[model samples]
Target: MREFVVQQNQSHSVLITGSTSGIGLAIAHCFARAGHHVMLHGLADNETADALRAAFAGYPGNQGFSSADIASEAGCAQLVADTREAIGNPSILINNAGIQHTAAAHEFPSDKWHQILSINLSASFFLCRELLPAMRAARWGRIINVASVHGLVASENKSAYCAAKHGLVGLTKVLALENADHNITANAICPGWVETPLIQPQIEHIAREQQIDLETARAELVGAKQPMARATSPDAIGELALYLCGDFAGTITGAALPVDGGWSAQ
Candidate 1:
């Protein structure tokens, strides 16, 4: 156990996975706007990475992009190496990359189950292992895991997703406890019904199957679990991530904070 460093309002170097689009993109923007140098990561080609990097040119701090595959332990290490080369060692790490598949537990494909766990759960572990040393040395760090509301509650036909997210929540708690005295806070943000491109196909399928308009389909999809009858915006989740990294939230660790429109309340 070591003493905690009270860091505030200082520009930090950040690494965000799955940041080419969706929720990850939103979170990247928030941190960049706040003057933190950001390393945006995803599985994209050079051209796409350049375009993504250009999009952040207007931000106050530096932005870098990487398409490093985080599906393996080596890939995760490579991503951390690239980030260190691009923007100093990242003081902030956001594990936002995940994939989903729908099938009953009995019908779930073994390959899909392994893939989901590798990317969603194991990649985070690898990255944390790679980054924790520097953070502990510096005596200040923030780790925000973008887990799902399913991490807090179960959902049928999402066995792999549920398992990965739930494991991620458990991991967050352990990281928090291990680093409590080192000033590195670890927390998970559990979002439900976010209107990302990832879920657009499901929404369309619901609309077609229910014989309803897209707007109605959207409502029904969200209303099924979330009590607010609307999806949470990616920006809202981004704001929460930003706040968690701030001085006021220094002591808030090991929390599975839900931004699920009260879905977890039900």
Candidate 2:
């Protein structure tokens, strides 16, 4: 596990959802390295949470803890209350908790779709809604939503994932407009493919199902699409999120930035 570290004399405090692993973890580390007071949120993983806290035990502005599922109203309320007590209200927010399943559109499980939408889309909205008042009063905030290439373009058997992300794009735009005067910026990061745990099993499943090498399985999805012909790095997205929250990005908002290595263009 990568340990999150905090740079000295940092002024920013950020809350990154689902930080126990993958892109979320990278984002937490990136902000921490910049010396931001980092709130690392994972979903109900006490063991992982303990390890993460141990990593930041001596750090200046780092802490690790679990947050409830923001997908539900009750969970969202609890998260806000606990965060308010633990850390100061966040100046930056990253909504990155999400899940996916591959099923034909008609056969897609309604329960699964509900779960995905509730977490991926609704959770973001609620977190923002809950946090916005404090952010507005402060007159400065950044909201970065972790969308996917599917948010901009559809592929086979990921209807719910795609729809939730698409809805996020719209939400980002509206929130940006609503908060424009308050120095609040909203944006979405749409990645093509990143070698995260969420996609690791998908790779194995496809490799076994299609009788192909792992590289071949990866290529089949990214084939001729991304000019780089590779998966993205969570660190890279983390860096971009850092940029968006910095002074230079003060004017950027509601933009869907694709870190897809040209997948969307193709």
Total backbone collisions, model 1: 0
Each candidate: how many clashes? 0, 0
Which lDDT values do the candidates have, in the order given? 0.93, 0.84
**Model 2 alpha-carbon miss at residue 74, Å:** 1.2
Residue-wise C-alpha lDDT for candidate 2, range 80-196, written one tens digit per residue: 776766777787889988888879999999999999999999989999999999889977788999998888988889999999999998899999999999888999999988877
Clashing pairs in 2: none
| Ten contiguous residues minimizing lDDT sum, candidate 2 | 1-10
**What's the lDDT for candidate 1?**
0.93
* lDDT top scorer: 1
| CA deviation > 4 Å runs, candidate 1 | 1-6
- Residue 47 of model 1 has an lDDT of 90
Candidate 2 Cα misplacement greater than 4 A, ranges: 1-10, 205-217
* Residue-wise C-alpha lDDT for candidate 1, range 53-148, written one tens digit per residue: 889999888888888899999999999999999998999999999998889999999999999999999999999999999999988899999999
